[model samples]
Target: MRRREVLGSLSGAGALFGLPAASAQGKAPPLPDAALAERDPERYWARVRDEQFLLPGWRAFLNTGSLGVAPR
Candidate 1:
C-alpha cells in the first residue's frame, strides 16, 4: 500500500471530510503529530477507526481496490 493510504488510515477519514468545515468555521484545533499516538494510543486509534468509511458490509479497514482511486 502507498504511504498516504496508510497515513489516511492512521489519521482517520473524518480528517479529510471534517477538517475543511472545521477549518472554515475555525472550530477545531489542529492535532499535533504526537497527539495521534501519544496520550492514549488505544483510545486515539479507536476514535480514528470509528471515523472511517467501511466497505458495503465489511466490518473494518477500507477496501480501496473496490472503491477505486477517486477517494484516494
Candidate 2:
C-alpha cells in the first residue's frame, strides 16, 4: 500500500486512545482493511518466523494468550 493510503487508514487510531472503556465498548464499528488484517488475535503470524525463516510451521501459534484478543 502507498504511504498516503496507509496514513489515511490509520488516521483514526488515536480516537480509541481518547475514549473511555465504556465508550469503547458501546458500539461496534466497521474496520478498515489494515485493522481487519490484524483482527486475528489467534497469533495468525506467519507459519515461520526469523530462525528458519522458511520452515513450514516455524511461526505458527495456538494463540491462547490474550483473553480479549479478537478472532481472525
Q: Highest lDDT among the candidates is held by which one?
A: 1
Superposition error at 44 for model 1 (Å): 1.1
Give me the runs in candidate 1 sitting further than 4 Å from their true place.
Answer: 1-36, 52-58, 68-72
Local distance difference test values of all predictions, in order: 0.57, 0.46
Provide the TM-score for each candidate, comma-separated: 0.29, 0.22
Tens digits of lDDT, candidate 1, 9-53: 978976788888976774333333567688889876555444432
TM-score of 1: 0.29
**Candidate 2, number of clashes:** 0
lDDT per residue as tens, model 2, 1-72: 999988876776656665687575655433334443477633333321322233344345455576533332
- Which numbered prediction scores highest in TM-score against the true structure? 1
